[model samples]
Target: MHKTLEGVQQSATPAIRGPLQVYLVVLALGLTVTAPSRLAQVIAAAVFLGLAIDAVGVRPLRWLAVPVFFLIPGLAIILVTTPGHGLIEFGPLTITQGGVKTVLDTLTRSGASIIVLGFLIASTPVSTVIATLRRAGLPSVLVELLLYVYRAIGTVFVEAERMQTAAKARVGYSNRRAKIRTTKLIASTLFLRTIDRVTHLDEAMRARGYAGKAPATAEAESHGYGLSIGILAVLLGVRIL
Candidate 1:
């Protein structure tokens, strides 16, 4: 059973500094939004691409698909509907010069922003993100809410997945009606279980000393500030330039 016991052990992840990562994220987002020229936007895009490939690695493409979904629709709708003189017409569809420029500008800005933000998310742990939010003047209630939602969602998923798997084993979802009924049952069951779990958690917290406030979160490593500040300065400079 040595192999079984080994499989049960939780592994650790490398520590990333919380505040520094958050700072860079804010800077990257700010610059991405405010970048004055195409060249500046290109620079931001390059930074995002470089960060994804070098630091975040495999997650960028997968995460990027989410934003691209909305972005593509926005581009298509704008190009077809916006009224302007210069038309690049394709049958019933017509895109004006202004529409094309606006769409291109939007794509560059949004795609770059999404990539950099996704890099931040893929690299940082949840605990670090919560801690950063706490320190960044977010209300304690909101911070706790964020944490609670993350935890509760996981619990809900587990319950739902278990029920789904059990139904699948019995072929309870073999047909369309069966699938609909099973899904509703699964959702309702998950909702009830989540409420029960929250009640138990509340009691447990009262037993230990949770006086309606969130617990104190930890600070980031001392060394990360200088590097993070340097990065922020560069972004600000680029935005201005």
Candidate 2:
């Protein structure tokens, strides 16, 4: 269990903690967009946040994949949905100047935010993230779900890799029809295997006294309140100003 948690901690390092850094950066960007008068102060705050993450050992560009998967798509959605004054029209597609500007600003801000987050995740450990969440008053159920989902995905990937390797070793190059048949067989096998593993895991959890709820530890409840409060204050100030 410990090894599994450790491995998950490593894998989630870039994706999980990166968001926190991104949020901090976004706070600055928000102030810049909404309260240009406070731009200098906001920039200073952002710099301090960046430095703090560095002091805590966050790595840069560790969670780049997350931005690619999440931020870009979200920006695209904003661009597509934003209403515009008729500036460019083609058939049914009309883009207003205001919409274009909105899209551009959203994309730029989101991109920068994602980069900041990616850096943090690359540097912070998974265990520390869980600890942080616990400190922030996150429910144990959510944390346990996060951990289980991470582990389950890893297990599925390992199983799939093993199946692919076995198939390649036993079934030499075949015609298109044969290949399709082999692919289907592999897919079917994988599905069945995954179901079996889930069943076993469910049974094991039950045997080990898992009652649909994760127990919170005292350590998780004892996170640095002052730091959390400071971060929240920054976030709120950005929203208000």
Q: Top model by lDDT, which number?
A: 1
RMSD, each candidate, Å? 8.3, 9.7
Residue 155 error for model 1, in Å? Answer: 14
Candidate 2 lDDT over 25-86, as tens digits, reads 34544544454333334444464445445443343222233224334556655555668667
Off by over 4 Å in 2: 1-65, 142-241
Which consecutive 10 residues in model 1 have the weakest lDDT in total? 3-12
Local accuracy of candidate 1 as per-residue lDDT tens digits, 78-148: 87787887677888878898888888888888877776665555555556667777788889888778667
Where in model 1 is the C-alpha error above 4 Å?
1-16, 59-61, 140-219
Question: Which prediction has the highest TM-score against the true structure?
Answer: 1
The CA lDDT at 84 in model 2 is 66
